[model samples]
Target: MDQNFSIVSLVLGASTVVQFVLALLMAVSLASWTVIFRKYFAIKSARLKTNDFEQEFWSGTSLNDLYQAAINSARQGSPLQRIFASGMREFLKLRERHLDSTTLVDGSRRAMRAAFQREMDAIEANLSFLASVASVSPYVGLFGTVWGIMHAFVGLSNLQQVTLATVAPGIAEALVATAIGLFAAIPAVIAYNFFARDIDRLSIRFDSFTEEFSNILQRQVAPHPGQGAAAPSAGPSTRPMGAH
Candidate 1:
């Protein structure tokens, strides 16, 4: 293979449309990778923080103390912490109003639900772009390949006779687009799948936590038989509940 026919040379020698496609694919690949790296770290950190909060929540810590800690942590708090805080806050406010157990639980659940949605939006950010790149990059590369082949054939039409030597370069140049396309698509697809799974797992965890927390709140608010209204407590259960 001549040095002139190297991958770099073939790319540089590609037709204008082919070059444009290559550039577009490369840019998309770069952006996808950036999102992948950022998402990886963000999700990892989220999981770790959730774990820490779970341990603290179930460690017999008082709800008031945990709520104060969550408040102090502010924006630095994990999704789980924020969700807990939201529910606890609502529960306290409703409790002060002398709301029934059902009303207290429902209001706290709504507040937690809103916080969960916001956290999910932040957690799943930029995931759609990864999905788009995964699904579309290959076709973009194929477009470049087809265009390169058409251009090459048109060039060959100017030659009186064609030989293998003359045909190979054009074919190779056209194939390079497909190669680059696969290169870009493979990682994006893999990362997309991985992130999707992680997000789903996090969602499940959040849901479980919400239900368990709600149950704990319900238990505290529910009045004892033959007794008057009982005071509500925000402390977590001694054992974690099995997920449904």
Candidate 2:
């Protein structure tokens, strides 16, 4: 019994197809774990960076100063920073042309939306692979199980008598493939769900920031009651502290 029960022996005794299936599952398990770890760190870093940048953004920093800083260190800025930068750049460009306020705001909004899509694309990279692994592994394992059991029954046709010893090992080894599949799948499924939720939250936050930021820019584009064309151009220095 001890001899028959060894995992290595069971695997070794498995048919070529079953062995291939087991190996495939193992490989998928390894890849899934690798993705899970990488995604974990990536999401954590994004969240932390977003939080830090948001704090700075609402801390009464002038948009011009913040935009300058963000542009200078753009690589380190969060998604929000990128969105702001895109919108600000467009807004500034339109303002330079002395475009109508409506056109300026529309162009800025369009630029921000485009930036938002790009940032989301970057953030969600490789997530589909994780999702595919999670969704497909279970069915793959079941296929292995079916193949192994069918093979086991076929082998019994050669025997005059059947016993637990004859069937248990074959069935056990076949089930191993299923277990390995589940092993590969569960964490991937969990991580995919967790990441999806987090990403959704981040998207919402980014969208909210976009709306608020748009309003601030709108105020700048709109002329103040007392100030006419003589008022200094609404640069970063002119941003209202409370608008953020």
Candidate 3:
């Protein structure tokens, strides 16, 4: 509480090991914040783009038209768009070979699944680092605190007359390491949980889309009564993915 006992002085006066711990914690905290912000915007943009694409897709737009648009906008395509493009491309190619409904649907589903995995991997990149920081930083800081306390006690052992004033600074400086560690950990924990939930929701969305699109493909490929092989519908079908 003394004016001379500011945080800056406490950190500066900390032992070398504690100082190193603080520095490491600070660097980790900075990196975590960077990931947090980047992931936040990335996920937000994905969700928004997905909604937009879904709306367009369900607006009775033609499948061929959608596929063409997807191809033209490949660089700006969202995860959903890429998944749709992959499935549609595979379906069209296999349909040309006169494959049965099951084979057509299965091939398209596989393509979609592969695209889904790739997108999920990209979305989850660097997420493990946040998890690590959240789970391990506290222990790292604790190690520094323990080391600083031992060093303080070793210094006190040589004193002829140890007093509260002599011990307070050492203990305070040591506790700062723990504080820094918690500071680094709490945000990473919260961010990791939030990003995890968001990513899970996106995964579910992708899964649902995959199933719904597969059904549509199946319907198109399946033989109709009294009619030979049906061609792919030029316009979008009546069925939707599902309600959100």
Candidate 4:
């Protein structure tokens, strides 16, 4: 153990470039792990909360009750809850104006769609950094390796005799950087892909919920008394009084 520690110290001391590369790899590893764990918990919580909310939403609960619940506990509510709240609020607003069924439904759909986009954006935040780390780490490691090798060769040029022991330590130390980079990168790439797929699935669920909510709105509006009601004109009619 002491010998290994001494070798590591030697490697770290021999090339500043290697030390920098290792430090970068360590940072990437820490960041990737943190994101992985955070996203895991976040996605898991979202899925569970979404499932619970869906059950309540479709279980004959009143829209007003659901909206209130969502507003009060919205931090714990999932994307579905927010979308439903937006749609219901818009539906009520349009209903108050005595809009026709088609217009009311259209307005509600628009609100839900906007909410869905917002939810997706939130869920996908920070994913780009993970992708960048995965893609760039290997190149960064290679740069360190190249620098270390150049340093070793420069030393070799000043030596009268070249031997295996003289060159092997530098090469081994250089390769360690590449290995560390791969260690950091591979898991990050895999986790990024996994999380991306999960988010896509959740997005699909959000879309389906929007469609189902739209259908529900259509049903609610279809039987209203204001089926084809239009807005009152802002100005007086142009026709002359009693001209008919």
> Can you tell me which runs of candidate 3 are displaced by over 4 Å?
236-238, 241-244
TM-scores, each model vs. reference:
0.94, 0.91, 0.95, 0.87
lDDT of each residue in 201-221, candidate 2, tens digit only: 999988988887777767766
Off by over 4 Å in 1: 234-244
Clash pairs of candidate 2? 64-236
RMSD (Cα, Å) of candidate 3? 1.9
In Å, residue 27's CA in model 3 sits off its true spot by 0.6
Query: lDDT (CA) for every model shown?
Result: 0.89, 0.83, 0.90, 0.80
Clashing residue pairs in candidate 4 (N, C-alpha, C atoms within 3 angstroms): none
| Residue-level lDDT for 163 in candidate 1 | 100
lDDT tens per residue, model 1, 1-244:
7986899999998999999999999999999899999999999999999999988888877778899999999989889999999999998898899878899999999999999999999999999999999999999999999999999999999999999888888988888899889989999999999999999999999988999889888877788898756665444443355521
Model 3 alpha-carbon miss at residue 90, Å: 1.0
Output the TM-score of candidate 4: 0.87
lDDT of 4 by residue, 1-244 (tens): 4453354665665588788888888888899889989988888888898999887776666666787898888767878999988988888888898877899989999999999999998899888878988999898888878888888888888889999878877777777778778888888899899999999999999999898878766765566475544322111221123422
Off by over 4 Å in 2: 226-244
Q: lDDT at 16 for candidate 3?
A: 93
Query: For residues 142-211, what per-residue lDDT tens digits would candidate 3 score against the true structure?
Result: 9989998998999999999999999988898898899999999999999999999999999999999999
Error of 1 at 154 (Å): 0.1
Q: How many clashes in candidate 2?
A: 1
lDDT, candidate 1, residue 34?
94
